[model samples]
Target: MPKSVVSLWLLVSACTTSPSHSQSWDFELRVVARGLQVPWSVLWGPDGWLWCTERPGRISRIHPETGEKRILLSAIEGVYARGEAGLLGMALHPRFTDSPFVAVAYTVYSGFVELRIVRYRYDASRDTLLDPQILLANIRVGNIHAGCRFLNLPDGTLLLSVGEGGIPALAQDLSSLSGKVLRIHWDGKVPADNPIPGSFVWAWGLRNSQGLALGRGGLIYGSEHGATTDDEINLLQPGRNYGWPSVEGYCDTPPEEQFCRDSNVVEPLYAWTPTVAPCGLAYYDSALTHLPQFRHSLLLATLKGSTLYQLRLSQDGGRIEEVNAYPLGLGRLRDVLVTPDGRVFVSTSNRDGRGAPQPDDDKIVELVPKNQGIEDTEERSLLRLWCQERQLWVEARAPVTVRVITVCGHVLVEWRGLPQQRWSLQSLAAGWYGVIAWDGVRREFSPIVVP
Candidate 1:
């Protein structure tokens, strides 16, 4: 329950032959939309829709329930649809309902490719994007290692993670805009409180950092790709160097230690040796209203590794307590997003040339828990056990002892005094189960079936 405890927890579960492996199948992988041309970025919009960006320079809004897709913005001119180029990340304005502004990062091809971050206003009536204004346009774009992920901070400024643009030296160069996390105001001006004067660079020395996450306890986390080994996750700080070319994962080597001490370089909290190619990063905090089990956790989508990683963070948010790696048989995942209601969605990058495509090469898939709906009881209307798809919800007005038991008389979980409780059946196998809620005066049984 403590924040620091979750950060230090680590669980390494490989997707290999194991009798318990079948429990992962309990999560129903449903394709929400198909025929997508390399869908790159996905987010749950403020308008109660799933907003998506295809690498071919188009924006779409998808209905979560009906799977009805609408091409909201298209006909994007001057877009470079090359390897690792085209439209990348997008973020809705914090005040989206009133301002209706959206920020997008894309590669503009002319004589050379350049990564540009721009803001666009949406016309709700026409369902179109209008009034495009370029915010940051000096970033050089590379065919690979073009890291541009967005993190809209609460203080009206946006934190942008910039890769070294395939050039290792650029990460160490303070003058270059590449290979740094830049903080800029919504109107494209550098914040006065920037670590460096007249510069937007908040942190530098990063190589292809694709994921920037701010978790509980004011800890800033980032994920970067390393050459062969040392794929890293860092505790990012302003004006800090992440040791990209000179140092990979940790500053453990003698020579690397010398540079680290001389340069005041910071080490990563965690790193992967074989290189998972971690991309989309999302931190689960109290902000998520639906998925309580996922709270105080960080989720990352990996490309080459083809896995969804869930890390339980500590109460201090300074450490990683545990990591649960869920392998996705689907080809190269590009993005991972969670909704306010606890629904998780991921987009495949299989159509991105490097990966072999499936029938729906670049589709958006939803991961649903097995037990979907909750069961109701007549004993007390306020006392309810509801399961929706794969999530079990228990609603009780007073203190009660809740026990989840298997059909074979094995108790799986037990909790006490929850006004409302939620449990994800992701790890549970398909079988019959019972949920018993015992108050001082009476006992109630709720049957659960997972198929």
Candidate 2:
């Protein structure tokens, strides 16, 4: 592989240009949950909980109000989480209440890292995920460029975006599953209307598309991470080629123009130079009273840019009229979720080995209208702490034994503490540490950083 291809998987270029317009909506950000390790996906469940997946394959449901996270599965079976490869995307069945099926895509080690899609039964009564069923398996995957975002369409079909698995040649190969948007029934059968007969591929020629969304008139929209320049938001169509290795953004270059004319490659709806590393995408046309200006728009979360981008759609939803950027100061946002009532939530990815992890990094933050009254839900943390002036301030809701441990699970300081306490951190080195609190009945964990 070329050095540039490897750099695309490791390094991300930050976007510095200002958005087309200023932030028009008056919104305040609230921290919903904290101390997550590389949260890869987040879904606003119909049952009113936030379903999230970490890169290490832990499936969790977080209470949107109380910030309590309940782990359903500690580690998915046979998951290979190294670098960018791991349990990536998830989707609840369209009729989740009736079907109760949760579908997930993960990179599993089959000699080499390969991709697999599995379905599990969400057993609410048992408070666990049960009965794993392998829906699709044996797709090629790489450390990076393993595009695996999912969208459960209304017609009871699943749409998955597969990356080229770091091989540029595989993108144009019709027989390969890489670099394609695949359509399959819930049972893993090829959709009847798929362009390729007996094949799950709905569209081809893409390089590491990480986001998928459904727009007006049942149109599919996708966000892709380009190699260096030309991160794209594509209007996906059935049987269309997106021109991955041949063309980066448009048919502007002479060679690309020749390929575009010969291959009939569809250009992107919008492209960003300097590469923003666009990840999760959400379409917002809800009945929410707040942020009416955001109506009929698409919310995009970016890793390198570390900003939530709002692309206002045209009246017919076929064109992007304007692009605006909202920086919440949370670094490397991985996923964005928009609820039916227009509630917006984003998951941070600062701890993903590429960012500077601050104290209590990798949190899920919510965006609310400034006029809306946010209820002050007293956070019940077994142990929580923050740093200020080189002093570590620790707090506890109840009597508990707190242990300050290193990232390798080595205990550095162990003590019994009450509510509101302080410890000097001037002697400690700059690194990551874990603070654990045990109340004899339950245990809680949080991450702290020393600077």
Candidate 3:
């Protein structure tokens, strides 16, 4: 095997273990916030704060450690909270620390409850919103099919999902913004590389897709609501139509009768029957060694199923299998997010008139892996190497110069400078390797995966 592949395999072997015979997984749940009326989405802010949106047009922040909650924005009018329409999606600016801008998607009460995406500036000193800017406007909305999801791509582009506006035909219409995935710049300008010039419609023919997430290799995936059967998870490509209304799950119609027969429609990666009502999605990239099976998998949140579905992706990127699906026992999960420290955070939407509510059911819950005393006997697995700090997790005593050598005993990465200094690993691939740390005269070798 190539050196990189061998390194990845070694890292996977070190981090993973045989599945436990016990069905119950070891994890602790903590209620991070409560008294939230139909919390829609939960996101980690740039300042390490957890922020959430309430369905009735309110934005709140929660202290992750203390579970303290503070209401930041409220009392905004025109939030249609019947069924699926309300404060739905939120996304922070890519450069949130410097820009302090937040984008929100909400439903208006203008006869038909139009969905709109607006941007607001956060006033840190006053702890409130300073200026509100309407970025996207005139999105048709109804009691159902108000698809509102936001994603701030790594390339600093904004991607928003708009539903079919309660009319299936709207998804096929190129002129309408409804039933389409729109891509725009930060300032609401259409991207120059969009499928059509002067058009925010990057891809079309989507139903009520509520979940949008970017995966490895810059692939975009979305979860959509089905009419009766065939809820879908689609692989998003620029300028590709998803064949909504015209075709439901896959191409079930004849070639001549298809809606986008010659318009380059894309098929879904995975589809579910009987509907899971998937809401939020996040990609896990092997950062958490505790749940090694979930590494590089897509964690999907479901409302109707009331369970978290873990889809293990194939290395070839063409197939995805449902590896694990477990019930949260919480009421109506709306969103699932992986924190910076490898903890899983999920938001519940019990107040939305869906699930059986309990005392702390409608709050955010964090999942922490329980250390089951295996660390004492089992070998310490190197989870990942953060080269920015130049820190190593040494398991045993070894030469400090071993990290610079290849498997064939050739030098790859070398450094000779101040001890314990931080060094960024921008030139490294996602894999496993050995790290050697020295404390004066003593040295130790540790394995690490760079995911």
Candidate 4:
């Protein structure tokens, strides 16, 4: 078979579903760790461990399998743990197997809290930190507006987010590192292809961007903190200026207006009102069958709303639509990440003294897919076929196909490929059924029943 035909077959066999069942999803909330004083960011580190940063300038490594926590680093220099100023962002090197380097963004006490970036080597054999290299420093600081997040771009360049200094005017100043995104080589050297040669600055005119993620087509997207309203998400381009203090969201001022008239300024792709206080962002790439509309959608973590906002993108990736928002109800979600195995992990910031706290708040939670590894034998009558396949869960308008068979090898209701597939057997009598789905090549079987 051709490659496309093979892919179609895999899709058919992999898109297994459970019986058409209707039940509220019960999320199994597991606390990864606690006693963390204002944990900011979490990243998967080398050697299958998850590394997390505490605002008071400490790094902790948590073993996902064993629930073992180890303190990695502490007391290098200048970590202001007051309010939002503390150890902020971290990213492991792409070639971590060989390099074993980790980058961190934090606030240092230089009379005033100043944002700084540093790189450290993790000695796996000795289980200790070896060399510490201060990559970038002297970022303007304030009680607020210290935009400190770092991400490694797909092209091996490191991207850093700098917030507008305490002064809003710094956002418009080209000379200041504040209120800009800086791109640099892995060794902390300025890239030659940077918009300004010999300068670490990549793009300017940002207010207080909190989250950064590189998505499809190498597009960099950032979520910004708005003053009162007009929280925005922008497509980050190197050397381009995004109107910050000048204009918020889409241009409300006219073309000839003073700040808005700058034709060189770029506009945001999407903006929200009442301020979601967007934090970390991640793109979902999973084999879940109910996620057709969310294939390339951006998962945004909101602190103010305590929800995960899913923004759906157009096919060509030029436009974005706010498809759905799921409330975590966990109080001040700070960072959201998807693991390599397609499990969604989110970090909460309720302990940061910002939001109302829950009993078991301020910990990481993993979201598991609905039907996998879960048994419903005890509540058989409560279970209905949510999908034609017995392994998948029900979602809105998803295609489902079912097959019925006997104990022996015999032909049964083999509803193979779904051209306009719709299986509504709610009125049918209750009995055991074997469901199978075919995508033109291979078949997947799931045992289900209607009671």
**Residues 296-326, candidate 2, lDDT per residue (tens digit)?**
8999999864568899898888899899866
Stretches of candidate 2 off by over 4 Å are: 1-20, 375-451
Error of 1 at 358 (Å): 1.3
Output the lDDT of residue 295, model 2: 85
RMSD of each: 12.9, 10.6, 16.4, 13.6
The candidate that wins on lDDT is 2
Query: Which runs of model 1 end up more than 4 angstroms from their true locations?
Result: 1-26, 286-293, 374-451
Candidate 1 vs candidate 3: which has greater TM-score?
Answer: 1
Clash pairs for candidate 2: none
Q: Estimate, for each residue in 224-337, the C-alpha lDDT of model 3 and write its tens digit.
A: 888887888888888888888877787766862465567677777888777778788887775567556577778888886456778778775456855566554454789998
Model 3 global lDDT (CA atoms, 0 to 1)? 0.71
Return the TM-score for candidate 1, rounded to 2 decimals: 0.77
Worst 10 residues of 1 by lDDT: 1-10
Q: lDDT of each structure?
A: 0.75, 0.80, 0.71, 0.68
Error of 3 at 35 (Å): 2.2
Candidate 4 lDDT over 174-258, as tens digits, reads: 7888999999877989899999989888988888898898677777788898888789888889888888777888886674255
Model 3 misplacement above 4 A: 1-24, 253-261, 372-451
Q: After superposition, how far is residue 145 of candidate 3 from its true place, in Å?
A: 1.2
lDDT of 4: 0.68
